[model samples]
Target: MDHVPGGFALNPRFHRIAAVEVTEDDLGRAIPEHVIAQLDAHLGLLGTSTGYASGGWTAADFARMYQVVYAVLRDTGRRPGEVTSLHRDCLERVDGKPTLIYDNHKRRRHGRRLPVSESTAQLVETWQKELDALPAVPGCAQWLFPSPGQRNRPRRGHLNAAQFCNRIFRDWIDELIPDLVDEQLDENGAPLAYDRTQVVPYGFRHAYAQRHADAGTRPDVLRELMDHRSLDVTMGYYKVSLSRKQEAVRTVAALAVDRHGAARGFDDPLAYEVESVGVPYGGCTEPSNVKAGGGHCRIRFQCAGCDFYRPDPSYLPALEQQIADLRADKEAALAMEAADWVVRNLDDQIRAYSKSADEMRRKLDVLPAEERAAVESASRELRKARSAAAFVPLQALTARSPE
Candidate 1:
């Protein structure tokens, strides 16, 4: 930010921070990739393990307690409190997929159940049976995660979330992950070399967001799934590891392929020759019509929404973003009692972009679907030809012609 008085910048005193204020990556406690991988590795080994000591039911219960809680938080993105207080019958199907319906302590929307992966649901089922057979909590015996002492009336009645977070994570999880056992950082995001404790259970939720982000889940959609009140909150943990970035790029590239071959007009929808003047939101058609640096525009609400400019539907992600932004604007207008003209304008722009999206699905008539397969096959062969390494005398190839 510029050091100027009353400047429009990310100075929190006057305004909110930038789109990404601070991400998990910026923090020191961002769980390392190996940590999550280790958790996964442990869970995998746990699945086929029947080496429970014959009379050591206590040890088996302890294992179930650890795994089930870990799995629930991993899959459902529930807080530790929600996970601990979860009932045995909290399992159910939502939209044909297994879901966990529990009180959302942070929000009032318990009706919006968190969808659980099939593996998680299976673990929950197994734990449920084990829990039912053993004993219930003193007051609520049906608690999925009840204390062993509940039946014997000793100590606390249910699984202590604080204990799980503070002690068990350090004791069990740390020993399980030797590489990270001694990793810690001070307040300055610097490593605390002398410290031997690093991993925490809360990072699992951040890990979940990172996983979805790595999978290329859109920010808005992820925010809804994470049940965050703001996109800023969701983005705090959405920045993922470098490997996930590579994976996301590959996934997007795969989407650009048609049945025949590489998607025709995959980069641009306008297929016509036009000098693109890159703008903040999109490209400008009438660059000559504006001034330099921060150019001028007759209607500059949005570059994509401009009449003089053409938007690319092949840019599916950006098109989707525009649609989402327009919807948000429309909602805001309605809520703020803005004039009908403003709402109508937003609606019209949304519909227009939506039409562009439809056209993109048609691939801008690049090659007719029936003719595309042959063209694509030939195109692939041609690409292979062009990509083939041309042979030259090895000496000549290696020799420098001039200094």
Candidate 2:
């Protein structure tokens, strides 16, 4: 089959079941008014139920299925190999709430508990309710949802597999949101359609990340919540910065302020003028780091040379105290940047040591009896280099005289 944009084979079965081939108009068309109404009702029920319904799924059965899969992904973020390890103990009831306990693969421990976010927790609550409401299939646990089988027995355990859920998601998208489907060509010029639902996954994670970003959550907090090991991974791999979103909010807020002032005919022309000037750049009016003998500081708010600079003299003593509070933030940011760089460099050194060790082992395997001593000496030198590098940071710290 030709690969679809999102990534599943276009299930021929959906075309038969849905009994309709979506045309280009259908693909590009807005969701029908009836569908919108149905969605509203579904959302209302889902909000009351807990959070189990799939965000995009229109049918109750499909929504329940997607909810279950989403819960699994939100809990583990694992490939198939780790799914079986997700048991009841892997979850917890904290403060009278049910929560997942994420195993830290890097730490190799279950004690590293990662609580489900509020949104995800809400979803799980609704899903659990929905799942409970479903009629139990014969030969299955009370919690099991009905499957498409003769006796409605629980679907095969493999149904929980990442690949399987991915496939199902693709098929569901192809059947319900046909416009999302696309075609690809094979080497023989044969056309095939694949499902790409997995590519975007209905933008749930995007929406989740966006909510925190919009609320001005710190990047570090976002990284931790997103389970990203690095801030760069969270910022670069996930999405754009929160600043852009804040800018959007600022734009709307500015207009609202203007509208309110205009309605009362209490216009502050100076305020408009200030707004027109916008934020200043570089060190034009503020105290420049240049005067401090430090290289030109790029700290936006701290730069005395910046045109947008407002001095402490302009503010009351109480306000000046508030401004002084920002010094801690500046120091913290600088420290975080320094620590991140140190960690990255240490990681690189560790990787290099591992590579060198592997090479030395290979050389030792092939060394002749006479050359064995020389090979062993080279290995010892490599180990010494690695050990010395480990102590370099500590040595540098001790070498520093009183500040």
Candidate 3:
């Protein structure tokens, strides 16, 4: 066939695009607390030994157990290819820190060093001893994750990332589903059935990034830890889950107020959901305003003076700044001999924002120190979530025209 005309044509594999179906929702979401609990419980049941080829458990199971747990603890968001391809002696003590020496094959970057926790280093040590003791299979001695399959391609014998995810990992999850409980609840208030689709091997990396983001890791630090070439990719993995957002919303709601700076009660969070239309620094409660995406404001965007305005402590800084700006504009209008209406408008805005700012500060000052700190933290999270790139307008993200 090699001698035939066009027999040396380019390999079809190079020409074909691989179409991998994404079977999960939000692949970047952290594994649920309950699911993580279930994983721990199940691993406890399986016992540590990688049983013989004749029965109970295999090396693959043990390798996966270590891999998943290590991935979680390390929180480095490494790819499965990187983990599965680790050499037998992948750990080193560099500058008194346990560092992992692995290859980022996908990026064509080899021998990358990552500082990891001592506990994770110990876990790797345990796996190394366990792998050494396990019954040897053909062509499997060199890899951290030796493939448990019978077919041996001696040159490339480690667990394939795709097979590890689609088969080895999926199979283990199947056995765990009956014992798994989801963080969500059904209409009957019962714990919902576990969604297996949510717990893929790759999602651990996403979870790692999220865990750090929630713990207030700086963006540049996170980007370095994630080993991404750019900050944009790192930001993609940083998401504040809906539950976190709701919690922040509830916290900020405690200090919510109307335009008059009077305290507003949102006893039921569900009812607060009705006032969903967001304004610059707060929310609009009027039905018309909410339905019109805050565009049809009854007070024409004069949020500080509108009865429907529901500003919380999160808006305090912006409100104070607005007051200062309005005052400056008023002075400028007075100096320019501007129309009475323009000067009066600026004066009214300054007064309204000043009243709101004073009320917000007064309420904040009276709270217990710990509660005040919590409110401040929640306000920060809420503000950050509001301005997250996911909500940015599409056109705003595009490059500006040369003109």
Q: Give the CA lDDT, 0 to 100, for residue 244 in model 2.
A: 35
lDDT string for model 2 (27-100, tens) is 11222223333333433232122222322222556455544554455333433323323432454668966566
Candidate 1's C-alpha runs over 4 A off are 1-28, 43-57, 107-112, 135-140, 149-156, 180-196, 237-403
Model 1, residue 121: what's the lDDT?
Answer: 90
Model 1's alpha-carbon lDDT is 0.56
Task: List CA RMSD, all candidates.
Answer: 16.9, 25.1, 12.6
Ranking by TM-score: 3, 1, 2
Query: Cα deviation of 313 in candidate 3 (Å)?
Result: 11
The C-alpha TM-scores of every prediction are: 0.49, 0.37, 0.54
Model 3, range 1-403, lDDT digits (tens) per residue? 6576553466564457754423332344667555776776665433133343422236555555445544534355687778878877888997788988889886689999888888788888887787677666557667776655543223247767776676656766776335677767899999878777778777777777766665545566776787766455555545567887788778877678887877885765555667656677577788887887777876667888777888888777678767777888888999999999999999888888888888888989999999998888777676556545324434225452333
The list of candidate 3 runs beyond 4 A from truth reads 1-28, 44-75, 135-138, 151-156, 238-250, 253-380, 383-403
Model number with the top TM-score: 3
